[model samples]
Target: MKYVIKTQECGYLFKNGILKKILFAGKYRILSMSGWELKITEMTGKVDTKGLPTELLMEQPDFVSRVVRVQIPDDCIGFHLVNGVYKQVIMEGEALYWNVFEKNEIRLVNVTGTEMTEAQVPAMYRHLIPSRLYKRLSVGEGETGLLYIDGRFEKQLSSGTYFYWIYAHEVSMKLYSLKVQQLEISGQEILTSDKVGVRLNILCSYRITRPLELVQKTDNVANLLYTRIQLLAREYIGGFRLDELLAQKEEIGRFLMKQIQGVQEEYCVEILNTGIKDIILPGEIRDIMNTVLVAEKKAQANVIMRREEVASTRSLLNTAKLMEENKVLYRLKELEYLERICDRVGSISLNGAGSVLEQLAALALPKG
Candidate 1:
């Protein structure tokens, strides 16, 4: 007898119900014998006992083969379990050859039919997982998230769970603080128009008017507001001299609002109230101003003293005129003088006087 086999397949020959040598692709010759049997098996693409008859792969481990080739379904994934424990995740396109023996069994399950997320999958299997398959965003009450796709602003999202299917587009979200916020523009050196350098500190309190614009219009709203404050303050200060700006610190802040009043509107930021916290002048300037103030006060004191002295002299002149015109007026003036003298003397010894009261009254008069 003669047999021929194709190059793509291997042939195994058995005679008289006993195993024989394996045959590769070619022609084989056998001599005719009594009670002779020839069994041929074809090994395509890969040779395995799985394609062979069931009797060939029975419980006999010595002669039986449990090695099999399995290719995970294109639409399914393989969760490799060993000893009933999760081993590793097998990608959809991955094909593996598993030899099941004793207690192990290899199987494939449909991934599309199951409710699972990429996050649930182990990190070691991330590279094989799809990006946009799971939702990554969720917003709660009193909060908002800004959605951006492919680095472009899409829209605003309110409180709720948000999902994105990451296919070809990149997804990202930015959360904003909606509660009232206080920003401090701490000590910033600003120069006045007259070339006097001063440090100005300001405080600004605000809340978000439009959450979408607040996030999309600027990279950092707080930073932008800070920059705006500095620029506006410098511009306002540059237009005024030192003395005026120092005197009207609050008023200068008003001008800051007037020049760029609605500037924050561009970014959807609302300005509640902006006020100057403090103004600091240079040491030399402060000392010089203090000296000038003290000198002006001293000058005022001197003027007041001279005015009082002149009024006292004029009153004395008027009193003298009255005395010269009337004897009664002169006597009254003398009596007034005597009373003052009596108040100063605790006890008195008068040489000629009608009474102690008379002595005391006459003490202030001239001897003549």
Candidate 2:
């Protein structure tokens, strides 16, 4: 029998259904009575020995020279790199690849540590790793991530990406927004000093100063601050009459801020600002306040009108006195009046007039 193996492939020579020898690219002649057969395999794939001993195949120097053998330890994984490029992940075991065509190599990685940073496995290669082997966490911008290992807090991580080996232990992450945040405590019903019921809507802006201390102080920071503010608002508002509250609304905010100073220090948070957003009055109280405001405005208008009338009367009296004391001033004033009448009337009838001007002056003068 005769056989030919291509340059890119090798042939597994079998004799009587048993492996005998490995043949590289070439031509060979054998006895037809030997009942020999050949199986062709690609050189780019793993070496298949057909149940033949690997050592037996290695005994052939021709086979050993053209293949690369890999042995992975139990505590380590392997990355297969062909021609300096990543091809696939190699598990913990023995494997063989044909090295006749392309350069074959393996890079080993230790799995003893729980975390695999970018230094260990660059971000470019992270996608190639199996999803089951690692757990990923991404902390977005304006957020702080807390890493926990086995139900215990480990360390704070700023905004970035992280990966942990899941086979090592249980890993978890909690993220909190670090930017200024607002909390609305709305629709709170409380009684004022005068026993007037009102609904208050309060708003507060806060930021986390020391996240570690905050977590130690309370499991839930938002709920704690909300309850504290609510109680303080009720306590402070209860001491002021409804009228006083409406008058000094800003004062209430300052009082609440002062009261929560201790809480802020203990909880490790900075209260930037707080204020009463809205003070919703009862229907009856609202109607009464509207009526009072209208009455006050009307009284102010009436006072202004009376003052103007008094000033006008006094001026008239003073002008009359000046005219009575000086006849020349009185005649000038009469002429001014006559000029105004002439502008309104086109013509005037004169009766027994010494002169037109004298008659016109008499007609323009007021009767005593």
92-179 in candidate 1: lDDT tens per residue? 5533332333233345655443223445454354444444343457787777888787788777778876555454457788887677
Q: Return the lDDT, model 1, position 168.
A: 40
Candidate 2: what lDDT? 0.85
lDDT by residue (124-203, candidate 2, tens digit) is 88787778778999999988988898889989999988888876678998787888999889999999989999999999
Candidates in order have lDDT scores of: 0.66, 0.85
How does model 1 score by TM-score?
0.47
Off by over 4 Å in 1: 1-180, 319-333, 344-346, 349-368
CA shift at 14, candidate 1, in angstroms?
53
Cα distance off (Å), candidate 1, residue 159: 11
Give the lDDT of residue 15 in candidate 2.
87
Worst 10 residues of 1 by lDDT: 94-103
